[model samples]
Target: MSLLVLLFAVIPITEMLAVRLFSGIITDGPGQFAANPLRVVWQIVVFFLALAVTRSAHHLIKIVRVRVFRSGFQAAGSGVPPNKESWQWAVAFEMSNVSSAVVQIAMFAALFFAFDPITGIVGAVVAAASLAAISWLYQRQLRLQRDYLETRWTPEAVAIPDRVGTRIKHSEIGAFVGTAGLLVTLIVVFARVLGGQIVTSDAIVLFLGLRLMFGQFGTLSSGAMRFARAAVHL
Candidate 1:
């Protein structure tokens, strides 16, 4: 378990380092490299080293996950038909997803905070707010749907609950609205860069960081939802 955690933590740090190196190369140009050839070579070597470590970590994580699943399967009586195979896989996947999301969020937040405290705080707040809203709504919907499923499976089936349908519609609307907000944020950031309110290189790095951070947020959200569902099944 400690090894697994270390692997998960290492991935995000290496990924962040790789991104910073690549971004520096793009922003600083060849002139800087020409001035310090050794420094440029060192950066290039470090970038590839980070990439290699990231890849190796990913491969090892998969192996660890498989071993974990197999161990659990054997302990649960492997010859008993493995009826919940899909559920097992789903649970395992969500477990890894949650771990990866958590590590990525912490790494990204630290990176941002190291660069600019205000940006870090704002990013954290946005992530927390978005997560809280979506999680509450999703959990409520899951409960309603679970209840509806149980009812349907009974000897005397009833119609689906109106609350479940309403919640689903609301969730869909929220998703679209969230997407629109993301687009608007991107546009505003671009405008700020153009207006010289933000440095071009800073804007690029910020955008890249934000993109990665939000992606992990989405993964965390979905993983939590599915993990909850898997729990219900259990």
Candidate 2:
């Protein structure tokens, strides 16, 4: 899972860096005016970035499910083993994340094409809030189902370690906030160096996805460490 996260995060940063560098060469050349090919080139670039963003979002959902299952299993063995049920929940979450991303990108693209950066950012926040709210509701429904199952089975209950859940929670939040801040700073610096033309609201949406991906990667990687710690302490 750590390897997967590293791959997802590194690939995009590398791809974006490469694209930025190539764009620089194209724009700076003597015949820069002649380089105006179709906008397809930009479209292709954004498509790849969106793919990476989607993967990260999917991975985060996977981590969240894994954690929940572990918590549920510890709470009550029930019928399914925690790890097994966790994967099931992860698959369900991944599907929902994909649907959410499509809606997010569409909404962001529409608003970005319509408004200025400030308005676009406001729209992105609203869109993100809506996405998060929907996801939360889905998870809540799943929780109720899990509770019903646990009650039916009446498996032995055990306390989950704070380290198992709390650390991952903190790590996820920190990574998200840190990554978002970094992206914002980078965009500001890029705007200064390359000019304000690059400061579109679309970039903000992409950064939001990037931060979300890293946060999931961090949380998933932490879960394995928590399991190891539990074994060692026992």
Candidate 3:
């Protein structure tokens, strides 16, 4: 929910981990010692720059979502009741934009600046493909929303009572977090044994966890919003 946390805490921590991870696997001879100070400084600068870019994008997406949702409402006619579910979907769709863009930027930045790849071509291809995927999803969602608006679809009436699903167990949250921890452990272990990088690989794995958790957060919050909306009928 707070973009600032991602910008300040998650972004920097992940990037620093990237820097450390790459510095190990992709060595540039003994001169690395002399250049480490500069490298560290440059990474700090890049982190701040990335943070700025991500923060701006995050805020911009929110504004766009708000305007687009309001426009859809107006297009549907002011007399119609709010379709809160549709607006909620719009928010999730737009947040995916931020999430995907951040991943692309962060990954490519890591490839180019932090870790030297096995081959230049490999790095280039991966970065391009990853970013393309992100862009494609971002555009696809926009088009979907546009199509939805152009056709002004109405929400079907429901007779179900407005109540939260009693089936959702409280342990689901613990299960989710526990799964995230397992993933981090697996990633770190593989990076160490296969890649032979300790500190850096661990950092990379942690960053992976952060991104995954952010995504899970979005999904969980969206479900919670649906429950709240259903409760409104009460």
The superposed Cα distance between candidate 1 and the true structure at residue 189, in angstroms, equals: 6.2
Reference-based lDDT, each prediction:
0.69, 0.44, 0.43
TM-score of each: 0.75, 0.29, 0.42
Q: Write the per-residue lDDT of candidate 3 for residues 9-113, one digit (tens) a residue.
A: 344344444444444434442455476767655655665665566566556655665565566656766453466655545455544444544554344334433
lDDT tens digits by residue: candidate 2, 114-155: 424643464355445433543443344345334443554465
Q: Show the lowest summed lDDT stretch of 10 residues, model 2.
A: 225-234
Which of the numbered candidates is closest to the native, going by highest TM-score?
A: 1
Q: Which residue pairs show collisions in model 1?
A: none
Ranking by lDDT: 1, 2, 3
Return the number of clashes found in candidate 2. Answer: 0
Q: Higher TM-score: candidate 1 or 2?
A: 1
lDDT of 3 at 144: 39
